[model samples]
Target: MLRFNKWSLTPFHLLTLLLTLTLTLWLLNVCFNLPTWLLLVPIALIQFLSFLFFHTIKEKGNIAVVYYCGYALVIFLLFKWFNSMAITSLTYTQWLGSFMMVPQPVFAYFLSSTLMLSSMFIALIYYFVIIHFRPMVLILISALPATICIRMGRPTVSSYLFIFMGILLLLYMYYCSYEAEELPYTVLPCTKSYWSTMSLLLLCIFLTCSLLLIPGSNLSNPIHTLLRTQVTNHLQPNYTTSTLPKESTATSAPTALSDTPIFEVRATKPVYFRTRGWDYYEKNAWHVKREALSLGYQLPKSEMNQKLEQKSLVLLNVIERLEKNGLLQDMPELTHLLEAPISPITYYAAYVTTLNYSHYMYLNPPGLISISNPFSPLDLYLNALEICFANDKTRPYPNEGYVISYMDTFPASNSREMLLIESLDPSTYNQLINFLLDRVWEQHNLQQAQEDEYFLKKCSDEMETATLHFLDIPNSITKRTYDLAQKITASSTSTYEKALAIQNYFYNGEFTYDLNSPVTPLDKDAIEYFLFESKRGTCVQFASAMTMLCRAAGIPTRYMEGYVCEEYDASKGCYIIKQKHAHAFPEVYLPGYGWRIFEPTIPATENEKSPLSLILLLITCLMFLFILYFLSKVLSEQLWRLWIVRQEPKIALEAIYSRLLKRLKKNGYVIEVSMTPINISHILLEQGIDLTWLTEHYCKVHYGHCSCDKTVVLQALQLYKFLYHVHP
Candidate 1:
């Protein structure tokens, strides 16, 4: 007890030691993968014992030191566990690809090594002057910058930082010692003020980072594309593609996409992308038909336990705009709808949602674009096929060379070939061409219809026939919208001219696109969202609306879902379809020829107006931002103030000085800050400065272990204020 000075092992010295040990252990772990757990054991044991046995007011100074050091130790060990788990989860190769996203182990080293070294620097200065105040602030500020730099670079940076810090700590200690006359041990410590300030800063920082780390309500997929080489590089140092040897193993089957470039496609025209199919729509859900059962039909099963197969042929291409649906480049075309195809033809399709680990079809349900059965008599049929290649050698989970295949088996290829050969075999090739030409010319009898001034009659005839088949439009609204369509195409005479005009009208009308809507009908019986609830819907709604309206006008029309090109690609030299665009248009089925595609949704006005409310929305959003920012600032400031107030001073000499001052003033000798409390107390004892009041108050406030009386606290505060001014 005689050798123990409360002034020794000050707050500044304790913090310095803590920062030094933490940084060293962290760096060693990073460079050598050394055991960080071993270093934490003794630090933890000492802290536990210190807290259990040395908690009294007389030993409170030591306890505070132990507490901060213990905190630093626990943080280090926890980080070590996190680093080990992170590293173990990935292969050495995967580490390189993941380096930037999760740099935890590197962070651990910086936190441990720099913090310990910085604390040591501060501790030396504290040893002499014993004012742990400003140095603590300096150390914290420097630590942040150090952490950032070390994280960006190598583990050795932390070692260099600590060594330099050690030099600075020793130099600062020498300066403080020279500046002091007899050392400031006679001056009492303000342990409460120091610890309080440190605690507040730490609390504020922790709270701030925690809040920032919390994710917002909405989230999106952040990972897009990663290079395979990047993953391999981390595992193997100094690896290069040119230097790496290639695999020479021979296999009977060609690997999927092995020789194919990642981004290679030969199609110049837009085509639908095809994945697997879901044929069963039940319980408000669409499910893929298991091989054993489909729409009330069981497929044949073989002794090998495999189900009978359905052959299907499907062709698809990546669309530029399909990413909006979260789909990849490949999509399924055949069996996309319930109806059978009318011909062996190609179509485009865009589907939403990508695959997960399990091979299943997940739909975002956004409408896909596709085109099928342009003009043939026979309908197309489709069934999914699973084909697996025999070769692939990637690591981890074995890469399977499996691909989804679509087959169209009806009106078999052999039958179609026979039909074409029999039809043309009776005539010479040139004679067959001449006969087709003569038939086409003979059907041009419509040239005389213009002489009858029968344009209006023709329109009415089309409308009447269309109403009987598809349209549910009332005569009055039908006339008005039809006139609106005519006003759009008032100048057109030919089929192309009329088609463009109708396109302009629908584009200009108050039609909307919606993704989340119940199925509704169109035409004279157009299903409208509540008359006031106007919003642009998805492609399905937009296409359905146009088809119904055109049918009411006596126009031959059909809705087509297929890929549409968003832009004309210079390299591809055509409109490249990145995504499927479902479209509905009028198709005039002519007498001699077949149906031709017509546009109906094109707006006459180039700048399409959006029906959205904007100003009020902006003001509401700004107000939310201001409120969140204000609350955060206020919380941070108040928490800081509380932390500073809670600090307990290290040296009991300050309490002793305070008590002696109270006694001196009561005994008629005015105490001052410039006057050392020890010297003043000695003089008073020699001259008898009656200390009865002070001894009683000090015992009650400092050792009674009960709440201090307000009166006594107020008296102490008044005494310190008076001494501060008088001593200065």
Candidate 2:
């Protein structure tokens, strides 16, 4: 019964095309590290299918609004689901994706979807403005680019893509408008159909562009190297011959660095070396438990080594040649890392000569050095066991039990002489004397042990009250900055601490959590959401939070509102802070310490630091949003009519009364667009306006059946003036 067109593709054919296009783009994107250009193919085909489906159905009046809203909601939700799992950058993909590129496809899908949605959203806004204003299409087209250039210079990829797509649709709309003019579809011709068509086309273009241009960046290309390297490493082990197994059951031979070395201590008595203590083990990683403070238990003076000792903290600059390696020369547990780069391979170059991924160079080889102790005599601890760094050049043959080992007894002193650690919360401080005690307990357990401490009613308990305080500021002005602070310091105590915490958070957070900051869809909570709601805030937001929170916490926080010191201050400057941007810092109190500086406005990224104009930038954003909102509402139908009617009514009674009704919108009075003349008169009078003359004229004409007159209208105008000016 159905007649098929030769050129038309069936639903099944379109569906197959959509799937194939999606898979092909994804595969190509992964293989060649492209921008996933093919990702748009499926989206375009789907859009066409959607159009076809909708074309078959008829929409009238407000029903179309529901249809569009439903479409947007579905797309946004789907995009979010995919975005949550998508890989955003190349470096990340290589480092983590080599094992699984599952997220990359997710990333591709969302990137495409987000971009498309953004374009559509902007197009919708543009269409609405045009429909509401009915501006000359040519002027609007010109204004789009002009405003873009004036407001935001040097458009970003997302913006460029959006504008480009929007403009193309705009041109199509213009073409349609011209066509509609040439061939009017209705007897009483109006440009509504043409404008409507244009709006729809623009929206479509925006959606398509957003889908094509969002996500992935050229900057992320280098990350492919890491991925490729990781893949290669998996297929081929990079360990030296000594680290490899020779036979299944033979005794492994040890290399030069395999044997443990002993070092003497200069202390008058023996002391224990503080090696890293392990508490919890899961997924081959160590997690240290927080130690509970004991008010009752105190460190004995005897335990404190009073003897003065000095040792230069040797710095080993390292350039990691392998992913498993770190920036430090050796894997020392106690050493604190300063300026730890988010990407070790990239930042390592600043400290040492770079080595290729394939090369192996040890700046500081494994060795033990003699350390002076406050306790034991140098001779007594001459052969004490300690942690030493090694390249693991051992186990040339088959090895069994474990790869590493520790000493069984005190090297040169009685093992019992080791001090026993005391704590009220022994369970919490799993280390303390527990490491040694646990071993003893295990042995005892094998031979039948004593009662459990808690079970035997030997444990004591204590508690502390939690206190909360916030630094409230006047007006809603501080909400954005303060909200950001709240998020950054959600885990912090004290305003001073929170300020420092927020500042530290920004300094440690992220700059580009995603490589690019793309414009999102309408549902996206605008820039303010980025600044306040999701407080992985920009530099200014971070800095503002730091300052404000510190101040609130009773710490001295200040907004460093100025340009970055591109050069140092002219004279007497000590540190020569070469700031290239605006920044804010909080001067926090630390009991005995007067004030310490904390920066909160740094980009939240592993390597990015807070810029010097975050304050200025924040203020600018605030102003921009305010202006934008104001402009968007300024030319609305209600606003425009109010503007026109506010002009003095110089007409007769009926006309003056009509104008008065329109102008009432200024005071939040809604004279329904279809208000009867009598109703308009009643509303004006009820609203406390002096409309006696107009009401009298209305009653005479509407109810008393008297004809309308110019004299009464003139009187109504005078009354309107009196009411609007004298008592408004």
Candidate 3:
């Protein structure tokens, strides 16, 4: 539940908050290795703005959460569209493809995303930590970034120390807030509540220490060890290491994917985990060439290390020179960051295989940048077109699969990039890639250029070969197939447009997607049969047909087999990949850019969303609760009245008199907690209010222990009216 309350910002509150935020962020900067002043200044702005917004709004209860969500959305859009650092003429998708589709995210891009994230987090901390003082929630927020950095291996182990201390201080503040009654619980400070609070405080301390310390990582504490092993293993998705043995073929009998979950994946977004890419089509089958199968080249780690070491020195010199010229204040890693390519369009995904298949290996999605396993260095095989593990080689795979950082955006998926790619001369993108390569060669490490020049050269060589390799169509391709491809793309100008045209051809309502299509006659070519005769097929058939057409249309195409995970488990915050999610698609090479996927599978219709359902549900829940609360209050009052009336006459008289004094006390007449009715009468009389009749009856009922009747109660009521000068 969220509440927006206008807080009285005392000096204590303001000072402590400033100190806490500065310390926490500075500590976090230590963990993240981000520039300090840049992060600090922006977050302070966000905090001030957020504080003003919340302070202005006086709404309370869960309705405030809706406001916060809307506010968060506005912040997201503001940064997404208006961020000048990374903005270019490219559309969002195009930008993602061209600029971010690199090995690592560039400086400004990383900072922009981080700043957006921090803005929202500051709003959260202001609400939960400052306004509410929820220690559990605050601790969770602190642990989250630290956990991510640890999982990604971005921050050093020593960085956890800063995070630990920062979180501990914040938690202590929350504890103090509660003790001072600023965030007192519904229950008062009784023995039970005292013990509970103490227990909770101890738990918070332990958790803060344990998470930052990474207790599972070679620790002596048995409790921490148990929590690490028991809790994590239970929550982790159990995916078997054995991959589903589904073979891709142009000609095969109809088949359906199995429901058995062969692997489980945990990723923020849905993606295609491609096994491999097929180059040529012949004899009614797609085939991988020898070059495609072989690992083309590997970069020596020493070369990367050497380049980094050189870049560091060069960057330092540049910063120093700029500082001497009064051009800049410091490097703070800014020089190297600016020289880096645009933000790499990638996010991290971690998945673990359930059954230990002796070797642990994750089926990383296409467009993978790097991967990591828990125990061993990743045993990987790569080529220009695609990547996979070296299955036959002697290498250790993590027993629990691995984590991958990947980006898999298709340039043709967006209109602007598609048009741009289409309009570009075939050699434009290639030349751009070459220019970047030579630019690297000309700068920094010019003396030992060959040492750091493997990947770009390999990509260039592969590009030279892809033309002859990917266009080799089957001899079985009929004249009608070529004619259809030509006819579809007759109006389309470029290779990207032609690929889209081919893809659109299958998505038209005339074609049906059938997983269990009848077997192709052995004599008929499968592509021809599917186009003219069957006119129905699974993803394999549709993708195969599209590939064949694109190839005939003089576009380089490859058959790609992969599993597309769509089923998202909101509970676990990851996607679940099953055997039934297997899919096949064609990768059409966009000259200079690289291979881009075109979907020819059955078109998934758009399902538009409306906020009406959620609004209605929320309204209903609140209304029901309001009515329930009203009824409960009335019922409790009636029960209390009934109980008092059912007492003995003497007791009833006293109770009746007690109500008059309670009313008198509300109007500035002083009364003691354990005052006699006579004492209250005297106290009220001094305030020019008399309750003598109540004093007499209450004395006779209690002190005399006499048999009092309804008349005494009646007298007390009359006196109560007279005390207020009302007619009875």
Candidate 4:
């Protein structure tokens, strides 16, 4: 039989047990959505029974208790699982649907269970193998709850409190261990030092409450935006689709437009900020099919026109700032610039403020110009004139600024002449057609050889097959798209004329531009519904309709998303881009010429600010100020306490003595303020502390006419330290 001492059930032991139980209950409440009262009853019962059995049972009964607790916990988990009839009866699809519905609580429960089981197992192993229970084990257990909270989305105040308490418990245990070595018979002072325990508990509560006052709590706070980009940009994908893609990609438009400036672009002329270009359209969404390949920096020619060379220098200066601030790192290697032949044009400079996407945005048909701060490395997805950077690791840092120099290219000057073939006489048209066909055949043979070499060399297959991909359309396209395209361009002769006719069809006020339009039926094709049935949609619908119409008309096209540089900031001498400026448009491929931008949708009217919106904004500002004021008040109180202790030594001593008396009384000592310091010292002597010299110093400072000296203060501090470690 194992003999239990009275000190075994010390206040420190009970407090630690209570804290552990509370943490378990709190996790169950947050993760499983279990009621506090429901969890409290079972947890309290288990803790009480465990404490009772621990104190009463001999060593032989330890294994039985462990087995019983484990079995009971398993039974409880099984009961909870089987209780949910909806979960039990679910088919695979139904199960998946249900899982998504309750993913949060389910994940939370799993995390909580794992933490509890792991803690128990760790404790049991330490006790059996090492012959002692180490409180440091709890420190490791703290990580589980913190990780679970972060995985659930964000860290809550409760999660942080759990971590803080675990740390506090570990420190207390360390203190106890040291005391045990110094005085083997001494009991834990946690209960004896009642005032100190209560003070620390209150402090923890105050700190936890302060955390809750922070905006978004576990989500993005004010400090986060100031330090880095908005949390949403880091977590979510760069591009998103909305029912009305033209209006907003988000579910609904924000009630009030945020004046938060996203980025500033400094350029001679305002240009479209193109991020990504999409090729495939299906079920109201646009997707990229090919993966981007990484291409390291390829050096550009230093010798160029004087004007372009000057612009490149200026761009390099801006890139230096971006790199210095840890924004842009290195440049990307483009396939067209490396493998395919390209002609250079004029170089231009732009200083951009924020980077929301992984790829660099540039004006279409970029040539071989050098970047100031390059991407760490670059990933290239080459499909016609559509170039994209897919390496997120090397992308620009979020919210940081960047500057780049890019050379813009123009299509072949005779591109228009090729389109003018339909207007020529039959002899001229046939002769021109034969010459072009023969030229195309010769180019095809050369391209085939290049492709074979590219494959043999293990070069990017996507870039080699770019033209084939540009012309490929999904087989899901309905006959209505082809019929509509033929009807619209029936009078048109050339490919350019057909594209112009299709663009005109949408611009002719036949389709309404509605941002708040109802979602298209899922059963119907998005482009078909937008074109034939619902002639009302946003930029997404309009762009999709045009892309499909052009494809049906034998004109290859690609869908693109970027910002329209409409609003210029005159004060900044640049363009200020906002989230509202995000737009989607289509690029039409001309055989000889590259992809050309053609706007099909009418510009949307700006939303008028309402009086109600202004009132809400004002109220929100006031509420924010109130939170700041509340936090200031809490902080001030704590500071005031420290000031009082520092400035008034005599008053501080009295307060400490009063707290000591309360602690003594809690430990079953009959302490009274009326008693002299000498009498108090006599009672404390029974507990093995000699405070006679400290009592005389206290009297000299308070009762006597003598000023308090450093020696007296030092003695008081030493006495307090000794008393702090004394057990009942």
Candidate 5:
């Protein structure tokens, strides 16, 4: 048997253990949403026993085997419990599907058990294979939980604290490893050198601050992007799939409206928040082929129309304010506001939850605006003012809100007259154009410079171009769609009238507005299915049908997806937008104006919640509060202990004394509950150790009722330092 000397646990060892345990508990609290006390107390007890077991055992090989087997057992038990609960089934496919549908409690239970088992596995590795753990390995181990928290979107103050502590632990571990190698235990140390440790810590702090100052520092790193993508992909399957509308695509299974609030906006009036647009239509999907237009602060002459210059300036001022207030530091778009042109109309919005999609939310014709945080590089397409984040990077939509100014254009006031003129005979059209030009010249009191002929030609060409753009549709469009379009518009005499006829066909209770309707099959046409087969669908289906009908009727139309804020809350002083508000509508491009908003879906009542849903919600809230209370209790206890260690000299003296005994036990020295400081000191002295001064002072303060002063506590600490350098 190899005789191992009992090692004294220094203040460093005690502090490190406490910090690591606290950090572990905090992470578990955040990630699992469990009661901290439920996890902390048992974990602390087990860690204490494990440390003692490893320290007292003379055979290192036995220690390795025992620790590994213990962790393996724990992992086995976790799986057994999970299986017994029926949270996961036997087949892989069934297991995955069931896991995705697991309720919060079961999910939390599963995650907590997994994390705990992971920690134990890491510990096993550290003790068995990697007996001489490197600082980098330790840092990586410490970062695992924090990484999980970030990936799960549960970042908390504790998560950051864990990172900071991990960095400090890296420095401490490096110092320990270096000191052990350089200074032999037999030699008395001259002095402790803290300069290197302090210098390294300061350098790390400086670098962290510098990184924050740089734009996209957190997101620009290749390591961060890779890690985030891997974690997101791994975990996304376990979460609920998003129901938000995507670019015109084959419809998926219908989903219920989530009562979860997404964002809130304070606007002068209700407006549609558009995120994406589709220009080209396939059999069942809409696609966009145009590349994004990159614009900076200076607007091009063509895009500068509609008083966008003034709007851009207003957005710039808001961005400046947000930047000054530290709210826009991460908002890359706001930082480069001068590079993009925006409309003059503006509103303020704040996010209540993270927007899962990469697209930026704006009104139908989004213009220049300021966001509260930075994002990854964005591509802004001109058609429908569509914005999409670059796919090469992973830019999640920021949870912060922004004050945005946008421009909105309504249909031309004379659109009706333009439609009538285009339908008139050629000689009648010429006469009408001449009459309009003469009236315009007379009203402006302008000189006749062949102005009537020029005006007549310009108006005719503009209307003709607009008509062709809006009416362009694929020849593959079904015969059924063409027939329906003609039948709906047959009674109408003008373009605007034809568009209205199609819109009214869907809106006038002709089709059922069903959010829970089955999806249209991929092989079938979505418009045909919605219009003829199902005759029941949500806004996306309704909008798709109307857009196809209008396009077939020679009216220019595009599919648009956005949020509609129909219900305003006066008490809140803002419009509350929820997942249920996600809407899709058709926009018809009029000849002389722009795309006009036309609603084809009839308004539907809110979905009534069943008693089971209400019960589940109540239970969730109760569980949240219950866990929160225990977490607060655990934190308060730890804080109190820290306060006593720092502020109370008598208590600090006692704690140091207790740590000495723990050190003796760790070093293979037997300690009894009845052993006094004097008895322990005698045993140490017999083994060529001296802690006489510390023993005497501790005894006086604890038993003799002698007051512990600052000098006395300092003397005890000084005496205890010799153990750090002594060898058995």
Candidate 6:
């Protein structure tokens, strides 16, 4: 039997419930695009009824059955009465205050059915988030709807994130409430005194506001973008059924690829039209790894057998370990570290027209932005492609084809094309790494991630998963391949630079691009064979070698293949793409940009850039630093408090004494280092100021040689309060 706890409803409880529920409803609506009143009105109604019903019922299960029955009967009557009205007019917003305005009674039925569903959900949220403060249950309930929406082709992740933060707060609130004796209310964390509590509260206001307000836009989210990348990589292949040639592969020997024209492009400039990016490379094959069966469709048996090892999907356990141990005061540094730089993105459109009926539609590298056809469109921060997975007869693309928009950050002329700044200057990243390492081990994070449920893991774990998937090298890849990659990119600092260096390495004349190359040995990895022994292969080998080498050099790279439409028919205005133009290349996942396509088979084109990117980089850096300046004051106060608390009694007292003198000096007093505590007190008294209490304690510890103990420290804390809390 589901039950409520003994705790009474407090203001903190109500506020937590309201904020969490608001976030939950917003995300749920994003998932289903539910009518505002349909979702809210029912949930609000259920909350009131549940509050009333919890007092009356011994059996809570009976209420759900009754609500659902009411829904079925109401729907039946509405549908029968309004059979003539279209369902489109039945939207909640379509009607106003009058029943006559909503001629469609079927809307009543839809409302009733949803009302029943909302009652059941509100009951769970009431039990978990509001009453019991159980994060796992609330997270489970919130995640299910979001997951369903993603699979149904509507992916909105922002809702789930807000709820996660809310859970942390409520969990902390639960801990704070334990100090009932000291707290004046049901929830604020109690220090020993009211003034210290005031200090703590002010500090919290600074930290929380800094965190929630600073992180802007959905682009800051990598898991959200990576999810789109994973979705496109897996489902896109199932759409194009024609034996039309696919490009992402490396064969030991070259075969005469057909020169027949496959697709035509109408664009301002030439672009590499990629079918999709393959993250896994093994046995000379660019494989799209199947993490699991996805989008309600099963992969072919050949592809399904070799699945990547499933990883932990959750971060709550690791967070539980981290938070349970830290004083509730640990969030300041986290907020300080998390603020990253975001640059603006501008998008350009590329039109792809198919000439052969069997040819697959090729998209630009970061994946699809949007297609012209009325297909499964989605809004991702990364703006990735969402391909139709229905059977060929019912596929979304038409015979004429679709247009894909590429972001300016697109590496190929184009494309986060997930990251704004991968580490945002290594200092912040190092701080994060050192903090994580100091707290936990590598194996623990992974284990927790493996056990985590979908859509409920850490940002770091998902970020790790997305990057590491592309970095894996099969055993066939030699150490020399790794060494060569590292050696070539030795001077490079960023992913793009490393990628550029590796791309240009092939052009150094060490490898040959031959269509009639000799077959590579079965004993060697195809890339290793090409780089060392054979040294004579086409775009296939060059692309594959660069892909592995980049991975070895600690850069996440994927092999991409599709037709290159460079031959422009200027009179016709669209570039003519041929089957012979079917090409393969390496795409490196640049930190600030999204997945970028690089031409490693030939010398990389010297990508020209306007001064805007440099200007954007400098501007973003300044903004990050500007925010950091404010966050630092909070951190400094917190650190000083920690420093005072942790030191020896004499040192703690001296620290407070030194701080008081510094504060006075800042206010324009010309006190010397040799000034006596008595002399300072006299000068302060002469100026109509009184810090006699603070100076007296410091004088006892320093001049009288009186012992400084916990009592003296408390007195010094009172002294510290007058210096900071009473003044500036």
Q: Between prediction 2 and prediction 5, which has the larger lDDT?
A: 5
After best superposition, candidate 3 residue 248: deviation in angstroms? 4.0
Between prediction 2 and prediction 6, the one with superior lDDT is: 6
- TM-score winner, 5 or 6: 5
* 1-728: candidate 2 lDDT, tens digit per residue: 12224345544224323332333333333232334553465545554554444333323446866776776676667665655655555443353333221223334544544345333433343333322323333334434433532221212223434444454444333333333233321122234544554465456545444432322211111122211211122211222112211111101111011000011111122122221111221221112222221011111111111110000010111111111233233423212222232211110010111101121111110111222112111211110011111223311111010111111111112111111111112232223123223322333233322332221121111101001111223332345545655566677554334544655554453433321233323443323334444544333334444444554444433322221222222221211111122222233432211123344444335543222123334544665575456446534633544543554333244455565665667657767778765576577678765555566676676566676544555555556654443323
In model 4, what is the error at residue 331, expressed in angstroms? 46
C-alpha lDDT score of every prediction, in listed order: 0.33, 0.32, 0.54, 0.49, 0.51, 0.52
lDDT of 5 by residue, 1-728 (tens): 11224576544334445655665665554444445655666667655555555555425565667765775677567665655654533433344333212212345344445445435633543343124434435545657666754444333224345354554454354444434334422332333443453455455444443432222322211112111221232112111112213234635344434443445565667777665556677766666533221111212123333333232232244344445545445556435543434323333343222322223333333333433222222322223223322222332343333334454433123332233322443234345445444343333224432443453455555445445444557665678889989999899765566777888897666677765566777677777877888887777778878888988887768776666765565654556665456677787754433356789987665663334335545655665575467447646644654554575688778877776667667767767879777787898789766778777877888888888887776655544444543321
lDDT of 2 at 26: 32
Weakest 10 consecutive residues of candidate 3 by summed lDDT: 221-230
- TM-scores of the models, in the given order? 0.27, 0.22, 0.41, 0.41, 0.43, 0.38
Cα misplacement distance, residue 389 of candidate 5 (Å): 9.6
Highest lDDT model number: 3
**Off by more than 4 A, model 2:** 1-36, 59-157, 160-612, 615-619, 626-635, 638-728
Best by TM-score: 5
The runs of at least 3 residues in candidate 3 whose Cα sits more than 4 Å from the true structure, single-residue gaps closed, are 1-247, 289-292, 296-344, 354-362, 384-387, 391-399, 408-420, 425-459, 603-728
lDDT of model 3, residue 340: 30
For model 6 the local lDDT of residue 417 reads 16
lDDT digits (tens) for residues 1-728 of candidate 3:
32323565543345335644554464445333344555767667666676667665535557777777888888777677555656345444454344311213344554555556556666766666556665456556666655644333223223334444445454544444344333532223234544464465445445444443342332211112111221222111122112322223676344423233334466666777765566767666665554434343332123432222122222223333443444443333333333433322334555543311122223546556566654356545444435344343323321234556665433323333333455433465466346445544544445534433554465456456767678887667878888998899999776777888899888778887664467789889878888899987667778889988998888878887666777775644456554446577888876534667778988433341123334434654665575467447646644655676577777777776766666566656678888766677677678666667667767776788778777766555445434432210
Position 128, candidate 5: lDDT: 31
> Candidate 6 overall Cα lDDT vs. reference?
0.52
Q: What is the Cα-based lDDT of residue 36 in candidate 2?
A: 51
